[model samples]
Target chain A: MAWEARSSPTGCINLLHGDARNSTSITVFDAKGIHTYQPGWLYVPFGEQDPHKLQRSERRLLQRDIALLSGDAGNVVRIDPAAKQLQTADGQTHAYDYLVLATGSRNAPEEVSGFAEGADHFYSEKASLALEKKLANFTGGRIVTGVASVPYRCPPAPLEFTFMLEASLRDRGLRGSTEIHYVFPINRPFPIQSVSDFVAPLLEERGVQVHTFFNTETIDPEHKIVSSLEGEDLPYDLLVLAPPHKGQQVIIDSGLGDRDGWIPTDHNTLRVKGYEDANLFAVGDATDLPVSKSGSAAHYEGHVVAETIAAEVQHRPIRELYHGRVACFLETGHGQATFLWFDYEHPPKPPKPRRLWHLEKAALNTFYWQLIPPGRV
Target chain B: MAATYQIDKTVDAKGQTCPMPVVMLAKAIKDLKPGQVLAVYATDPGAKKDIPAWANKTGNTLLETVEEPGLLTFYIKKA
Candidate 1:
């Protein structure tokens, strides 16, 4: 939506989408026609099923435009952090003026052996979909949905899936028959005290069996089970795990990120730390911004970055300070939902019953579903 | 029947957010006459959700919700 509002016939706007910039053609769709877009997705019109409760096309969005193509490169060789350019495995160079590093993190299964496997399987979409098929026929058995480590992207996502799956199970009459357990490392549901404290009571209320103080260090896929780093065995017919998250090594090798592979950026201006002339910013999962790696933050950061860029364009002073702001919708079962807003100072403060912060999740999901038509948010 | 009213307001209850938007909206509409319109603009983001709920609660009409391009503009009508 930002780009759509800003881009014009004479505007120098080029959007790039896809997890890895190496192969943009197959994984993303670029729509420069003025509106919202993303990669591998597009905004399907909203209606009765529209998550935002708004009319279709009455909303703007970021849609993924994907077209599987040949001659795709598998890896990125080098990225000039300051220049915002990439050299792919096939040795092609792509450059840009303004870049949005929404390279959402990829997942790595825990030490649990063989837990996540298969040629058609993956830690992301292409792979997540494959795994979704792998678990679809799961009838009656222990299905474990949990994270392998902390500092993961979308901290509440796993919990959201738990609620979603529980609903799905009840709809299919699999609730009483199957055992659902949520295994997390944090003593409470999540690490942040504000979130954990707020959710502990709620978790018990919903009967989501909580297994705290357990971190899966290893996986035994063949046995369909997981072993905690502290020596515990959790068997499952289906293991849905939020694998360990890591930063893009490309950014690290380029000497812009920290040991964790995230760019050190000024939360206020998003200017890469320690370089004034560089004049670049990082958003989404690739940034080390002190907040949950949620797309909403990126959306917020995107607006800030765009404004800063616009200021630079006009030689005016940049006016934006990313105050570590973020909001999420906590989906409780049965048409009722909880809304939350959090950040560095506020670690997910619960919004009063009647508010819109809760709608952000559904709205954002639609924003993603419809907006990114290949790349750039 | 055409009714019109004008008012100026700004709410920055720093530590207090959320339902605050609804509260402010209520106060803004209290003196409104039938056919009169109310325009509430807030940066809190909470207003997006709260104002609509307010409309729903009072059975008033939501003429339009222009939450676009970053800024949130809500135009509401008295029931």
Candidate 2:
């Protein structure tokens, strides 16, 4: 059984389904009927992308040979890995020979006091659209954008959003009047050292206030102030935060995950640590790997998992292994972008931002559905 | 004359980009015994840095590199 959160399961199914010789039945259990291209949500508030265009029926993106269990029947309530069976919310029991958990992480605004009511975010479709309306009505004041916690999906998203927001404000003639404060929990602007070196100066040049080591402690909606654990208070007319994230609730309830709900997974093998021989694997944000939880990471891991499962089923030697490869295009605003590619052993050395890379990123967005899930690229 | 190592496996990654070239090399090298040599051919410029980094991280020995006009061939010994 394949679970859904991001595109990992879909990519895995595409590879496995393409093999005509392999007659193994593929089934996907997804409660959400629509699959959203999450990265596009960054552009939704800026009116650069329509939220509708970023989504498609999950059934349509999948291969015809695969069976899809959606709605309540697809909502997995419990996963009994010891029994090698799954129980759904619809009161149905299903057994599987191999289980791949791709149920990704979720934004947990409730983790921070008053965060859900005080802050606006672009992590979800509803939130992005809501921010769009709020941005449209904005006049000018203090606008704060930052992360509430660590290990969130799309590690570069907060930086990208900040840059784009600055550009958007300038275009709307609100740049001079508005103060953009970019906050980070860590001392650096980015997790990767080289990338931080490249970005820190850029933010400084833009006059974007940088607040490092500011872990959000609480938000006062009435006073419109965000306080940090370090005893610093920031006043803002508009608050945008990349909320704290947690793994799927079902995994936590079943005692399969850590206190934060992240599954303990083998870094090299992509297998659930203790369930290595049980034919159980965790991909994307479902695993507690020391890697960025981005769609590109998921795509690469999906490829390896597919190959590993395929080799096992064919009684062949499994050779494919995950090396924590992640590639992302960072938009630096004003129609220019930079590229980042790195693995577990190497750090990223991002080139100077260029218009060409931005165009390539736009092109990738246009062909995402065609090239990504089908593993065409 | 320098002694030459015999190639036990060859991975053609001439047209691949970042990650794929190294990914292919990793997969092919796994099938070889320790001390056996795996040859990887690539055109992606990133391979020059990535292949060696991967070898160093995985504890493999990069025996030699043959660079032509448009292609690079790397011979790595499994460690």
Candidate 3:
């Protein structure tokens, strides 16, 4: 979305990645020290496929090489979460002086019965493509989606999937023949209560039957059946389950995680509570810090963490500090998007603000594209 | 009339937001030998505000800054 927005106006950034495989690669020995800061990219769904003018940022992606990816590359393995040493599957070792782990959260299949054991569970990338294939073969049938968890990654994603699926079905002219029902555990659409108050009416208007505030329990993959803790059996030909997301097992196993399996860190500084001398920080969805687990948190966290690294190098105190910030774009279907932004520093509880928070979610997307595409290192 | 720098080859981060022009200016000026100056013109509403503030933070001296009708002009002496 940021890339799309940046494409609207005009700009470019010079990106210097520490990974040499990255298109704009820069390498600096951690012991020696390095300090370079610029805005960066969070990959979006849009690519260069239009017949008309190609956006400058789109052109840049087309120009770059393959990325190793961040969270789910599967190449990176955890040696010891407490020790914070990562050994790649290819036998490479990296020891961080100051570590920032944005390993992100994973879903709990234990919350929903048989979801992990099924032949069609769509949790990771491998499962995603597998489900996509199943979707291709699926002609006219009932597709049921249920929320078994809350505070999931990309909070608006489930709804976005619904919208895109509806668009696809309608495009195939199977709307009448095919049935689609979305089950939400929350009574509201998503985000803050204020936005859900506005969107609940909208989701209902669009034919999405929302069952809010229901605590889900089980899914019998056989007989194409499901049952809530309330003993309601919702049958479906396909089940897109947003399972209960929890902290990584490695964190929990190594005692770095709380009871919720999340790493606890100071919300303001993003520093692990007892590990200040450890130079360890947690970002993205992994931290129990009071912020959304979206990539925006990781991106914002990267800025302050980068500053800390730079400051430690020059014997200078780290001036910049994290503000418990988060940003997100709610895709409203039909090419229109709503944006949101909030920081924890000001309010005791960040208000569910909507109607306009363009700087963090909307304009930042534009700014991100311009700055990340034509990076300045 | 103000001094115009078209930025023909490179280092033209016109119309960029906060922390970007700041990042770019730092990189551009660092490459200079000594006593070298780069004339930058930007249209972002925030760039006019950010450049001077970043200059103060990094110890780079902001020699002269001019705000014209539709453009922003900055003159910085590399420290």
Candidate 4:
């Protein structure tokens, strides 16, 4: 929504987008090789091929008027009590009246032994395509999916991936010959009790073996085995792991982030903790808020932050507060999806899997492409 | 390349990157007649690929492309 607020006459705007550019299209495109793969329903809205009959549309961000700077932020130092400036890696400096740190988290594969070399990750654009190649060649084997650590982006994604993989295998006629194992660090299938209760039977019915409390300690690449911290060793022919997550290094280097690199901000106001000035706001995965680090959560946080900033600019009373809202569509194979919407006050009691939620998932992607990036909210 | 057809409207999407150029083109084409040609001038490296892909995806007819020193121009007819 940074682009939408640029037209405000309150002040001139300069938006600094970090150097890294990622496209989810790479994942969607590579999924063509897998059976029961939907293109536009995943992440990015770009349309090319529709494998699983996903809705397609023209949705993209346009930042024509917003002043943009693309580079790595080397340091963010407070120039004065009311002033802060960021120096880019290229030696350029930028001063800001209000600083919003939205630098997302990164995956740390090196934390696990052989994880960097043995397992394929679907988190990154490059790794997703690489995993697609691996998936295309696999005929039948034990496919193991596991989470390396807790508090990762999109908590339900690994579950969704596991489910989708089973669907794809069935579609390719490999279900009878292959085994699907989902290894999660948590004791239950899902964090929320209601969700776990709802999904456990469904997973059992689907024949997906759930291995809980399987905190990955190391992976023996040569033997194709994953050893958990609790002395459980699981063997797999193909391994897809969700690696440990860490906040951006720049945030840590600037002293604005905690030891693990996440910025501690007020959950409701999103204001930085130590900063004397309330102008320092943070949103998305970078914040140490007790919420799921998902794009939908970030989008909701964006609304609160945008409203707060606009109010500050217009000299109006700042009244907006974020309620830790989150909404996500869990894509279960067979052309159906379940909807989850909850907040700090409301725990998730997701509805039953329905085909309509699949449409809702598609609709959100359209909304994300059309409104989210443009700052329309 | 020289222009083969008259431009009905021009969206100077120069200095803009992916999504913006196509987004501007999408918005600009909405006001044009069905057969009217809209020209988009852009400097974003991705626009060369993104614009054509967008036109193809949206069923718009790409009439011609003109290459310049620092800018790339595409004429798309609303479909």
C-alpha RMSD between model 4 and the true structure: 24.8
Clashes of each: 42, 0, 10, 1
Candidate 4: where are CA atoms >4 Å away?
A1-62, A72-83, A276-278, B1-79
TM-score of each model, paired residue for residue? 0.61, 0.81, 0.58, 0.69
Better of 1 and 4 by TM-score: 4
Worst 10 residues of 3 chain A by lDDT: A1-10
Residue A281 in model 2: lDDT: 86
The predicted structure with the larger TM-score, 2 or 3, is 2
C-alpha lDDT (0 to 100) for residue A123 of candidate 2: 93
Model 3 lDDT, full chain set? 0.53
lDDT of 4 by residue, A1-377 (tens): 22111111111111122111121010000111111122232332112223234222211122333333322322232223244655555565555666666666778887778998878877765566667778888899898985876657787877777777888889889999999898875456766657778778888988999987566778999999998754578999999887888877767777778756777888899888888374777777787887887777776776676567667665688777999899888877676889889997797887889889988776765454344444544
Off by over 4 Å in 1: A1-76, A81-100, A110-113, A118-123, A131-135, A351-364, A367-377, B1-79
Best by lDDT: 2
Each model's DockQ score: 0.01, 0.02, 0.01, 0.01
- In TM-score terms, which candidate is top? 2
Q: Candidate 3: list runs displaced more than 4 Å.
A: A1-96, A107-111, A117-123, A345-377, B1-79
As for candidate 3, its clashing pairs are A2-A365, A6-A366, A12-A374, A13-A374, A13-A375, A14-A374, A14-A375, A14-A376, A186-A212, A187-A212
The DockQ value obtained for model 3 is 0.01
Candidates 2 and 3 compared by lDDT, better number: 2
Question: Which structure is stronger by DockQ: 2 or 3?
Answer: 2
Write the residue-wise lDDT of candidate 3 on A305-372 in tens digits: 55565566556777778887766665444444465566764422323334354234445554554453
lDDT of candidate 1 over A4-90, digit per residue (tens)? 111110111123222222333312112222232221111111011322232223112332342211132423446575665655556
